[model samples]
Target: MGNTINRRSFLGLAGVGGAIFASGLSGWATAETKPGVANDDFFFVQLSDSHWGFEGPPNPDARGTLQKAVAAVNGLESQPDFIMFTGDLTHTTDDPAERRKRLSEFKKIVADLKVKNTHFMPGEHDAALDYGKAFQEFFGETHYTFDHKGVHFIVLDNVSDPAGSIGDAQLAWLAADLAEQPADARIVVFTHRPLFDLYPQWDWATRDGAKAVALLMPHAHVTVFYGHIHQENHHMTGHIAHHSAKSLIFPLPAPGSQPKRTPLPWDSAYPYRGLGFREVEAQRQETQYKIVELPVRKV
Candidate 1:
């Protein structure tokens, strides 16, 4: 059921910090780095799990909430160089037409982003159906690589399985991709699920992610940014750092925080509860980067 065709043959294109109280549309976080590093630095935004069609006691106005995130990014005094929506652009659906509609509406809404360039990967809800045909129809290939400034970014699709697996074909492609890159190049990976086994009982770990991780282990500078757990988590594999972004929709309980994994209900008294975006600044040192999590606020 997984897409076995070499996605590369078909295709193209395309962190975390503490709480700092701020009045901006989103919370502000800044990363500390050596002096002069910020000179050649660049910043980009990451927003995940908008869940556009979700409706219930957990954030009744899901669509409006996503709009506010867009507005928050637009309101930034200095726009990021680009934006990446890690996954779950729309809530899952059984109807094919409705699925496409949700994806379309999501695109239309995000099209208003002041930053022109945007990259997207698929979450299980977005791609598990029909092997992501609907998502690819509106967006492009699920897995691909591109270069910007100097960093090399690899966007992997692991959501074809509910348990999350990258499969062997993509691994081969990734091996070949890394073979061509300079060893010193800064490599950033993006995916929908945690590539490592964070919590298997809740479907949080990737089935064959260990194999992929093994391949990446040879690389000196590798950092993976992903979303799906719906909360901020930081982990390290060898020299690489893996960071999960907080969701724009609703927050999920921390790994094994409770007996089961469930969405934390939004508190009415607290505005923009458990929703925010991550701003990443690339420092002058190829291996150094800083991240700030900005929570959504009333603009």
Candidate 2:
């Protein structure tokens, strides 16, 4: 079983307050996705755990590393319709000022991008302590739905409640939200923590993910994307496919492979520093799906 590492304790040990990354650079990951002629037939980028306010051996220049991730998204030949930053935007911090500063800087970075729509969700690092109240103040609605092309986009907040579960209130909201959609509509779900049992010991999987999955089971086509694990992990459960993206902060060991897992330390020797994201192109008018992990380095 692959394990997802927890970043909360790591942040405390490193004492990332105020400014976590004054300078740093990590690795790279990117996917090649060309858009079709249809304006609506475009792919999107998934960015997670940039941890703008982080300074550790994993990334001596975390700031630079996160910048690279944003640059890659902006440099795409054909821009994505929008960008979704699943969460862990800032390093875990009890200091409200640091949280506010981190998100403020994050906004500046994304504002520089050319994409039209960019959304966010909170990770445990962000919500475990504060319930992501600061995140909501910066990004607006944590859970909402929208239609893109023919796909129904649902952004869920798995970090809003204690125990890292979707909670009864949000669960009810999700049920009602899906009820409003037509039967045949395709759906795409975005979140910070995985909705499946990727690794229970590490708190990587959501407590009530199965209930949420059940809600989308009737749909003909569905895809779920998430972050927080800091690596590329994918699984197909029934009709839904779940995928995780890499962290701009640092790399982590594969799930369950080690007695303890944490983000891999920065290997300056490696090109582009070891940071990356995911590129997903929802196949139009078909059940087939294509998703490629985009590394900061050349494939």
Candidate 3:
């Protein structure tokens, strides 16, 4: 079941888009916030598909729009301890200087971010152009794991293959990495593309996503956070929940539902107002997390 909560009122392009609050069963927006990081408390930010290179249309000014999102996130009342950007950090093309310029501009824009920790993973646009060689140089390891608040966070690199699948080596590492996790411990996975067969025609789903999902089935509490869809949506298989983030760029049409899978025409009357991030909160031990989508807008 799903519910539409508060339309948090995000900035829309020239008053086109309005805030939308739709959620799944995990809907619980808390008024009381836990102070600091506790034994059973912690939250992180998820921002994806910034698309720094693209220009015009949906967003008349992509760079300006992104800057606005930066401001909105930096000014959060309860600032997240860290943030993760899922993918599509840059536009297409494999120019080394262009790549450096896009990344440098992105970093420069974020230099003013107040958050203490910020993590980044490459997407097809960033990785595919150079086979992720430059991506690794700029952003470091594509696949790695971390333990936070007793929760396991596995960031995978699924953008390498044109088919959008995790190669055998990464898959093997993931299985071994997750083999010993206890049922009670929370396991959260992050990637640029989705892990499900969302829409193969448009390259929305991960080809080898089932393998990853199978490995994750043993864990009681598992949430997979993904980007690249450029919009908010969710799907579930067994106990695991899969979520995709909204892009700082333009919104794409829903998967499979689209006739041609092209960038649907943005409602010109309501321009693009964006800069959104996802918030995942873990309450008491073993309690499912409270995930919230926070969209950034000009004040």
Candidate 4:
């Protein structure tokens, strides 16, 4: 039997103020299976681009948004197995002291989460200025790999170089990591920027992302989740799937939709319009994952 998810109850708890989208994953199985062993299903939450210290016309409630998201996640009827913040936990600041301060405050806010099994990465805003030194001090390694029930999770650092490149060294590390896994392993990658050249004119592409994709091409079941574009996007790199998450601070216009990649204007009537997080429920036996887009605040 497959694991059952109470979608309606989850959306109700998450305050489903926006549209909900779903996708499927095939050939996903547990890491180790023994006779009579059952494959259990689990879920995790992905929250990105909170921009904790941002203050601008794009979002009047900048200071309060991240808090609202934390409260919403805490309110979930079924707490996620883990939580992941793809990147941009704080806004960009050139001042070293202020940057660390913002990171500290962001950390403090999220500590309220009901679920403590959380993972983090960095966005250019939090890392580029100092090549991720401060972020590393706060969040540990920028790139790493961890195994869940049956899935291999890889967190790649593309923003730390300032040049927006993963660099050859990390690519080699990624290659070595993949080589140790079976060719048909169920792999998921988390990164701050899109691994493909979504739109290079606006600095949305990773410098050597193609190389990273090439190294991942041999894996049969691979998915990439990322944030930075500030909107939901889905794309395919051959057999691999890449999904981008929305921002908690504000949303940007669709790729190449405008001359500049600026945040969409704040709509006073519809506060938190384009800002939200997601819940990903992995049904291992069924070989699919359901993603629910949730609002920052309940209506």
Candidate 5:
């Protein structure tokens, strides 16, 4: 199917952020048809930091925000090829039973999505307390890889380790995985923490993410999608691109924008502000991606 997004569908989705087109693996570029290998173009939905059991002043409708997001995705004019929740499916809980309960609740809520080919990863809130023991019981592996169309996707587990490191074992595995791919292969990576040190004082940077970047640097076409900071951020490591998704529960302050990293206060006048998900359109043939951020609710 053609991957062009129609105006009606775009308007109906209620985008809150401007669309970003990443091309040439270095900076933005206009969308143009390039003759090359025949590859299918596809798009996927990215939802993150739901914090399912979270309750407090940061958000008054935390209970309903996630459900609203699911409904929004379901109501899309065209269903995505797949949906990926980058992490923090549930809020942190000290009690193991409560953690399991939150995870179970989150699973039930998202099951209502019209598209069933959904993927998931864990955030520190859901895994750090138990080293992903509870999360693994719900979701499968903490890290794995798969291919769609002509693109190879790598989901790394950085939060499973309390110190926020991808660990030596996963790094070696990543090297092996990259070695199997051609230098010009289209690659996408998903992780909870930023692969580069965005802000170490606030725990936003992964401990050993530099090693993972080194493994990916040699590849010509690589893009990363990650979430944990509860905001949308785009960065580049040499020719590779990294994009962060917004949170579903609440928005956090910008990286090192304040004395401490905390959730921006709930805005009564504008409900669900700074909270939403994103849809990523990937043109495998051209090695280009377009990102559109959608609101949790129509204003």
Candidate 6:
């Protein structure tokens, strides 16, 4: 489904402790949208790398930044059909109890979102903790498939291995899942790391992503959304368009822009710099779908 609504405004988080919208959403056109209207046009927000429980100079109040993101979503003029957090829900820890605590806190914060249908995927940070045991307990089924509004959505777990590989089981599952869908179905994939070799030197590429990409190549309309590098990036694999969303906590340098892969320092003067979500305006047609990436706004 596609919408013509001009929800193109940016949200600036005032400070670290309290999340306030520096700029509000304007230029919205009212529609006859009801509580549960089955329309052909709808949109969703992609929020990633909130990094709750993170404490450091890069972002002191990681928890509050996530809260601000929630507030920004709630403050939308019209609620999105759904919201999906691409991963790194929390900063990782080796301690079992501490991992649970961080996930628990993240769940509590996201519970405030007005959007009822929210999806989550795991990044290396969460999946590396206990080899995804702890993450699965908190968020069920790291990799799965679902259908919504004539589109086939697949969530892949590519971070369970430190080297970033989606194992054989998941690959077989992906093959089976794709086999079920029609050849022309509009497919959307969500994951944590870049499915392509964007920058292998920094652990940015998914080791087995080529296999998955090959599986998806048969599909005519495919779009992949993921986050791990903590920046907005776009790439093309055959006909698939892969987009990476910005982090809620802090932004990282562009692919190979910096000598080292480190979180860019936050500027106190320009707060919320490079921290926000990706707004996707998707439109669905009979046999195909289209996606347009709106500007990455600070929220």
What TM-score do all the candidates reach, one by one? Answer: 0.84, 0.82, 0.83, 0.91, 0.88, 0.85
User: What is candidate 2's lDDT per residue for 82-135, written digit by digit as tens?
Assistant: 888898887878898888888888888878877768887878777677777888
Candidate 4 error regions (>4 Å):
1-24, 30-39, 288-299
Residues 1-299 of candidate 5: C-alpha lDDT, one tens digit per residue = 13334422442333232233433332212233233543455677788899999997888777887887776677766788898999999999899999999999999999999899999999999999899999999988989998875667899999989999999999999999999987777788999999999999999999999999999999877889899998888888998888888888878899989999888997676677787777677653344454444443345
Query: In model 1, how many backbone clashes occur?
Result: 4
- Residue-by-residue lDDT tens digits, candidate 3, 97-199: 8887887777788777788588888899888767787778777888898776556789999996666779999999998888776555567789888888888
Candidate that would win on lDDT: 4
Please list the C-alpha lDDT of all candidates, in the order they appear. Answer: 0.73, 0.68, 0.69, 0.82, 0.80, 0.74
Q: Per-residue lDDT tens digits of candidate 6, residues 1-299?
A: 12222244424323312111111011011232122343245677888888888887787666578887787667767777898889999888888899899999999889998887999888888878577888899889888887665556899999888768998899999999999976766678999998999999998899999999999899776888899988767788876778787788888998788799888987766666777676665543222323333333333
True-vs-predicted CA distance for residue 27, candidate 4, Å: 1.7
Clashing pairs in 4: none
lDDT of 1: 0.73
* Regions of model 1 farther than 4 Å from truth: 1-39, 285-299
The better candidate by TM-score, 3 or 6, is 6
TM-score of 1: 0.84
For model 3, what is the C-alpha lDDT against the true structure? 0.69
Residues 91-210, candidate 1: write the lDDT tens digits.
Answer: 999999999999999999999988889999888888897788999999999999987655678999999665478888999999999999766556788988888999999988899988
Q: Model 5 compared with the native: what TM-score?
A: 0.88
Worst 10 residues of 3 by lDDT: 1-10
- Candidate scoring better on lDDT of 4 and 5: 4
How many clashes show up in model 5? 0
Taking the tens digit of each residue's C-alpha lDDT, what string does model 4 give over 1-299? 12223543443333223334343344655455432344456678888999988997888778887887787677666678899999999999999999999999999999999899999999999999999999999999999999877678999999999899999999999999999999878788999999999999998999999999999999888989999998889899998988888888889999899899888998777667777677666665555545555554445
